[model samples]
Target chain A: MNNQLLPERTVYLVSDGTGITVETFSNAVLSQFDQVRFKEIHLPFICSIEKAKEAVIKINNTANETGYPPIIFSTLVNIDIMNLLKTANCIFIDLFGTFINHIEQAIGHKSNNSIGRSHMVSDSEKYRNRIDAINFSLSHDDGQFVNQLNKADVILIGVSRCGKTPTSLYLAMQYAIKAANFPLTPDDFERNTLPATIVPFKSKLFGLSILPERLSEVRNERRPNSKYATLEQCRYEVSESEKMMRREGISWLSTTTKSIEEISTTVLQEIGLSRTLA
Target chain B: MNNQLLPERTVYLVSDGTGITVETFSNAVLSQFDQVRFKEIHLPFICSIEKAKEAVIKINNTANETGYPPIIFSTLVNIDIMNLLKTANCIFIDLFGTFINHIEQAIGHKSNNSIGRSHMVSDSEKYRNRIDAINFSLSHDDGQFVNQLNKADVILIGVSRCGKTPTSLYLAMQYAIKAANFPLTPDDFERNTLPATIVPFKSKLFGLSILPERLSEVRNERRPNSKYATLEQCRYEVSESEKMMRREGISWLSTTTKSIEEISTTVLQEIGLSRTLA
Candidate 1:
């Protein structure tokens, strides 16, 4: 047996909501400790004292079985439930308690102590804006809603499979930005001019380009052995699209090495769109 | 002037990649202190020592201007760059350093120490899976791809405007789960049975219902004064859909008060789907 195999520990993600915040936060912290194996137990929606007691029993059982104190990462807002959970035979990391106290002290006011408001669609205006943005983006994807170009906060133009759809959707979902994407086809390349449909909204247009090799590889996954996926075709499309963007004085970014998050951030920053949901 | 108003603090989110990890982490932490205002500065793609120096200068300037040291929350992986950032006039919260050290000691191995791998699409299989899931979810949204029901990991059925599309997209994007959503129409309510297309995938079906008043309010915003936007119609559809779900032995939840994150998590857990991406 390899002695280097680190001992395993139990980690519980306890929350009153879906456990997303606690899970993501714990994962970010645990990711730093790559050597220790973790058995994650998610105790979600533990809002009541009874549920908290059940969780404590489960945590104690795990500690007994493992001969090590389990680590509990909790985002519970109810003080009673949090106090009950502290009774478990584990190293309780109250992820929210200390921070909430600090914040309350700094603000000189008590929080509403509401449960599960972090992701709630509580505000009618924000909810409506998000829903509207989602519907608009879906309808306008891949050059489908050219007639509605004026509705977009930003329009993304690029060759096929250049991270346009995902970035647009991210911007819409995360920030309620009305983003539309249009594909530049071979015909557009031959014309060597901005599409007539998008010229009216030139200022809102952004271009995404990718390395020809990467574009070809991405396209080949969906349409194998086709002209659309050919490296030569990819090269031509990228070259022409960059030229068109330059001539039109539209800013562009390459998506070759960037993730969807990176691409969306850059697009929002470049277009000066505020993140409404954040 | 309101004496209770807390002074604002300057907070920096620094990372080598998309800055998503640090941004999300800091936001989650800062959200607890809602009374204390914050001015967020995002320094993304800080991969080199030169860029780190520039960030240091900016941080120091903020400290001087604010008369309080800025709070630097960083996820830097490079030791040299991390060390250089320490020179900044700020309260440095080394988000990754101590954890890396703990992990190194436990694992008896060093991390790859590579920059910007958190959001990298370096693994072709994972990237392809994510892209495929996105395409599949989009095509199957809103009862569009009934013929492809068998391909879905989970199928969310609900009345119109029950937060189905955004939840499906979130599942696909965050977990690489092929989620399909179908809307139950008035005709389906009259028929009083599961749709023919989804009958074969009964085990994979999940139901989303919403409060009738809230549903009507949501629909009224889109199509005012229509029968579809009537509270009576919403009540009928929600009642019928819940009955159908019960008869079919499919589990269900209400999206009236839950966030998209909560809805997605419940669906995945109820359907026994493992999260493929973090």
Candidate 2:
């Protein structure tokens, strides 16, 4: 068997959230190597100190079985939990280590505590920017906020029904960005004016627009019988969104249609927020 | 200001499906260079022939605007579509080149003739294994074939409330593993034996066991009032599941206190999938 060719190993992924992103990262990175066979285990939703210890015990047991060693991938693992993991017979790869050091160096801020996940909240004030970005999307419809849009971490203005929600969520989850999206509406057509609020943020403003037919199909799924779902209506909306963006000199994207991941990464790349979300 | 310092570039991430993965790659890689100011225009749903032309138009416009010339970070962009963007004033970074070359050389496969967003589904049988791996995650909850346990890319055998579903889905999506899960019901625990069909696939098997308290909490979330969520019941089930795994010589992971990402990544790293998915 190939088992004789490769050594057996174990890997543990620890995280602040569900370890979803960390898992994805670990899989992507480790899959590059095929010479080793690993035994993987998921430990989700361990939100306290006692739970971390429980994990440590299980990991210790796993190491004993592997007869070799293990690799632990942890994201935002509390120091106490990390220490507990240290007791296990293996190597630990902490993703948060560099980030924490970056944060401390970037802000010259000393962490208030060293034991728990509480340090993440020390800069709670920055979270409002993300909330505001969400609120900005909710309040600003289409090119209305085009001019002030420069304030956005990443301004994603798209045609109605373009895959915006998923892209936004992906960016937020992956890179911790304040991604704000505003959809181009019918009114955006007649006036074709970039919103005053968006004027200041114009530099940061980016757009997402899709094809008429694609937009219609997506809309039709939600409201099948309405004129809004009709091809003619879709054509008009697409035209208007395009015209409005052009009039305001706002260059936007056409998701008409791209996969959510594609659009998200593209958007993150275009705007400076690529660094934030990635 | 710095727009001139690092000319805003356009990186195309063309894909079928959701484009979530490749897009993240583009963003992550690019974001590392803080000095690079790029204007990303993501084209999703490039699977369509029509969307191909539209993508070209956007590429043209962005290249003209970003005067220093744009850089297209394209993933899964149709080569035909590339024809349109090729003439645009930019440097294109093609993602499919290496992958396609690798496949052609290794698998002797004829690439699929379909349009824009289609992944490299080769016409040759040699590449079928890779395609199977890629599409593995799409079919989950195929509960009809418990007897076909051997067919699974990965089989998760664990007690209930041990983070199985999410873990299964993660494996499928990340590794394209057709993961089928069978919960070790209390009856099995009481009997201390695995399902009869799982005996042959013991090598491909993985077990998840959660600590009694954690299992109780997880179960409580679904069914708040029950002996099933009780610490005593959890202890009994975990003990029985462990005993069965030990008797069968199947390796198991403890889900009692780890995150799902950690679990899935551990598996991906252990079994080895692909670099990008990790």
Candidate 3:
């Protein structure tokens, strides 16, 4: 480590609101650059061009004051504000600009105007189904009293008692995702496929399949003497439902053993979506 | 792109809760297994020896039913679960066992019998600091609502108008985190340092800086003619606040140019903590 003699290099994640994703992706990436002096800052609500210019100027001045030519990682809405910072002697990474370029490249078409990250995964078909399944699940199941999950920003699907409710509430509370979940039931096994209503929006469909034994154990906690808690029932329903999934060729992932951090990230990555940071 | 008949593969991610991380990690490691029928299930709450035994039986049955021995990727809580599953005809990838082994072998001393991925990270000092920073940020400067933050499971930090209140309310209503927020005041800038009380818990510190113009624009919508809404003031405040963060050695992030999903993910990652997914 060159800690004794090298000057610290810093990178700033200047943003508009919670500075959640930019900071996250940047931190994760920066973690890979452990040797560098990378720093981040959150500048929320930079909606206007003038404010962007001033932030740019401030960054420039701060760079000199700190004796470090800090790199500016900006995620601003105003394009012109980026321009005003042209003379700032630091790397200006405009996430929006990068996204626009990526969109233009990914689609093999360059538009007259810029694009955004939503365009990054506009091609996801499974995400569409998950959303549709969620809406249908919400409508049919009452979403555990969550009211209309049609507006859900996120959804959870897993075997019975696989921590869907708590996870949903966690996302809703921690990230503001209108989260919802639906258990894979014997009914789903009898049908051997996702609900018919889910067919139209297969792209959004995300799956959460946990171990049958675990499902049995959890259900046992709630209804110990009933068939729901029986390993046989758990086995039958899980197998049949999975068989049906294969028959229909629907792709899904298991949640039989993972942490909440991993599960949340899986959901985000699956949908090409991000969650709000604190 | 050689489709190659979509290689038959079975992926597994066993963990204590939601199982999202294993799914992502498995997918990232997919290239190593090009030939196999993929089947994975997440196992929840493997805190007991009896439950772990039941899980093993289920896995054996799954392998038999699928007509192929499974390749199991798991994160179990109890070492006994691994021992129980050892006899099963499967290729097992156990995260906790592997990591524990590494830690044990590296220090020439066995670990403190800590199990689970969440506990795995908790064993590290750096992760703890980052997590502490996020948690602290979530509870800091709650304004006149003193002591209200004591009940907070998460907090939102950002400029004047970065959707903190909405995000806070969403979390409170949906997940039950007593979320609270405070606007970064001029006094904080004058001090150019975090509140003294924050020092003990810098590990939970999280900063949400937004784009200045966006802050001004949002303020403008509410007050219309106040100095807080002025573009110049927005620029000055953002600049000064950023400067103060640097002077005080506070690492912050920006909230601009990101969707709510991204923001949420960043915060969760920073805190290095997750509410019970179940």
Query: Highest TM-score, which number?
Result: 1
Q: lDDT for every model?
A: 0.81, 0.58, 0.53
What is the TM-score of each predicted model, taking all chains together? 0.89, 0.40, 0.37
- TM-score between candidate 2 and the true structure: 0.40
Candidate 1 TM-score versus the reference: 0.89
C-alpha DockQ of every model: 0.37, 0.06, 0.05
True contacts kept of 3: 0.05
Tens-digit lDDT track of model 2 for A1-278: 56567755667776645455455545434433445555566654555778888878887787687664467766544577667777777666665453444433432344332322211222333433433343354334343444445545766665666655545544543445656666656665666665545556676667777787767866886689899899998888777777777777776778753544456656755664444322
Fnat values, candidates in order: 0.31, 0.09, 0.05
Ranking by lDDT: 1, 2, 3
Error of 2 at B81 (Å): 21
Worst 10 residues of 1 chain B by lDDT: B98-107
Give the clash count for each candidate. 0, 41, 97
- Candidate 3 wrongly placed segments (more than 4 Å): A1-9, A15-21, A77-79, A98-162, A169-261, A264-278, B1-149, B153-166, B169-278
Candidate 1 chain A, run of 10 with poorest lDDT: A98-107
Report the C-alpha lDDT of model 3 over A1-278, residue by residue, as the tens digit: 66455435656666544343344334333332333454455554454677677777777877788776566656554456557765676666654454444333432344343222221223334333332333333233324544444555555655666656544544543333556665666676666666654554455556666688877866775687897789998888777766765666555566555534556656765666543222
CAPRI grade of model 2: incorrect
Candidate 2 per-residue lDDT over residues B198-264, each given as its tens digit? 7677777778888888788768866898988888988988888888888887767886544444576
